[model samples]
Target: MTVKVFLATATVALGLMAVPAFAEEAPAPAVTPANAAAPPSAADLLFEQPQMRNAAPGSTITYDYLRRSGIAKGPFGAPLQDTVTLKVEKPTVAEKGGAGTPSADARDIAVTMFSGLNRVPAGPFEDMTGNPIVSLFFENHLRALAKVLEANPRYLKLAIRRGLRERAAVTPVKVKVGDREVDGWQVVTRPFAGDPMTERMRGLDDLTYTVVTSPAVPGEIVSMEAASRSKDGGELLQEKLNYDPKAG
Candidate 1:
């Protein structure tokens, strides 16, 4: 199985200052930056992260939907149509202090349905001939993961932990942010050599993801994208990820 992961975060420079929030705040205590957490091992990282909520049970978040078309296929492949829709849901604010302490915290969120479509040429018989449809699903998954990680680093952590425990592969990467570089990681999730697909489908190859960090906030994530193709263009389905924060 082949897997890929990518993540990024938005980093606004001083020149592009955002309007400051009006909320009152206490000064943060000064402290040395502790040892940066090491990237998880390929195996551990993919299988150990926490579950990403499909939708937070009691919270609401906004959604951003992005769609594009006419994506180019790999060399020797037919041109394909593609679309992606993502949902970002269930954002909750928390207290900044300890995990359970009543300090000030804001915006806990989750993402789902990062799906896309890519068309593959059908056989003369008009049925899909290979694995393009299956590959598209995972491809969209990876793309969504990459984008969400860019906007939220903590989400990346949770995704990695959950993904690894599920038998995923991951790697750390360095990406550019405005004028700086940040450390990021990627993860791939899939079944072992002989896992079964649902009744209607045959076995699937693999599902992989790469998560990166945004350069500016380091804490914020920016973008994600993925691509997939089968040896023979069979039937490609374009999927998209749509993030809707308002869905609690």
Candidate 2:
């Protein structure tokens, strides 16, 4: 597939950037320059890491999914619980990514994000590269949240981009994978808190996003959650996804 088409898909998926990575325009690996920078931030690990490259080709990774949007005085309804899967299929043919190619993370791997007839947009992305699940999660989350709040998507996107880049906190942690505990990292950020347009959120302003990643996991991502509740803890809206070891 052409690099152009892959980038187009990325634009629709996350529509935001910290390191310009929804695995977009990923380039080939290069050496570290002498005048290097400090250690990577949570944003860099979460966004720029070649998460997909860690997956074994021909393997399948699964996640337990939950998306609930029920704010008593809001516009959403009940939650949907399902299982989401991503299969790491090898490149069956040559991909024209010599020059002008975006990020090469998983450039040789293709993924199938869903297992059934889901309403989420399906790309002609069969030939596209990068981590499809990451793109899918952001696309679905931002679009739905915007609709639920009746707020502009750009505003929300900006808040997230800014939060991750400037205020996100990253900490080392451990996660369970079967009977064993594995090292992992947690990245947490509250993009909507103290937002200038708080009132427009109708109480979703404290939305917090937490992501966990472990190298031991097939897809690198162990879990992700985006949630917010009302002041009195009455209304609630939460979206979460966790890796399913049994399904691996």
Candidate 3:
């Protein structure tokens, strides 16, 4: 199916978050295709020093977000605010799938998310929940960041297949988190070449996602933001990273 169709299906599927619980497994890391005509060099794929993978198991990053629906400011509206914590865990085994090679030594880290004090399950949805769209958004965002940090080109292709792209330009940006000001690269990825409706349905028009990574630590995503608006151009969702500190 086309990326637009896949994104629409994804949004619908995400609406049901209360799916059946199954055994949790480590997420697979991205890898390059063996038969590609041309491939990136090891240096091109490797993350610089102080990578996200270097974080100790207990390190945590927190973000604060707000969701609003309906008119920007009027009756029949739904607005909510919450916090999500991403905790780093020890390396785990990588999932199967990739160039027929054993993934034995591949780096697979487990990063779990918590909404308030409730643990969010890993993997796709199976049932309905309150705000599955937002949850799934963060999950995919972080997972994609993880793969990119590991220098996997396949991850970019996977994102394209899922309706995201790698054509976004990297721009210099400054962001404030808590009391500190961070200088990083703002990488924005849009849908593949297509009609505007596809972009809108995928929330690309309503929301602009920017991944911020410090140049000092190339692949580490220091912060991210999603600014969204309603169909009628009203405010909808606001998500921003609040704090990210190394585990002491």
In order, candidate lDDTs are 0.29, 0.61, 0.37
Sort the predicted structures by lDDT, highest score first.
2, 3, 1
Write down the TM-score of every candidate.
0.34, 0.75, 0.46
What are the runs in model 1 whose C-alpha is more than 4 Å off? 1-38, 41-101, 108-163, 191-193, 198-204, 214-219, 225-228, 233-248
Candidate 2 residue-pair clash tally: 6
Please write out the lDDT profile of model 2 over residues 106-169, one tens digit for every residue: 4344334445654454342443334556656766787888777666677677777777778887
The best candidate in terms of lDDT: 2
Cand. 3 TM to true fold = 0.46
Give the residue spans of candidate 3 off by over 4 A.
Answer: 1-51, 71-78, 92-112, 116-119, 123-166, 190-206, 215-219, 230-233, 239-248
**What clash pairs does model 3 have?**
16-127, 19-126, 19-127
Name the TM-score of candidate 1: 0.34
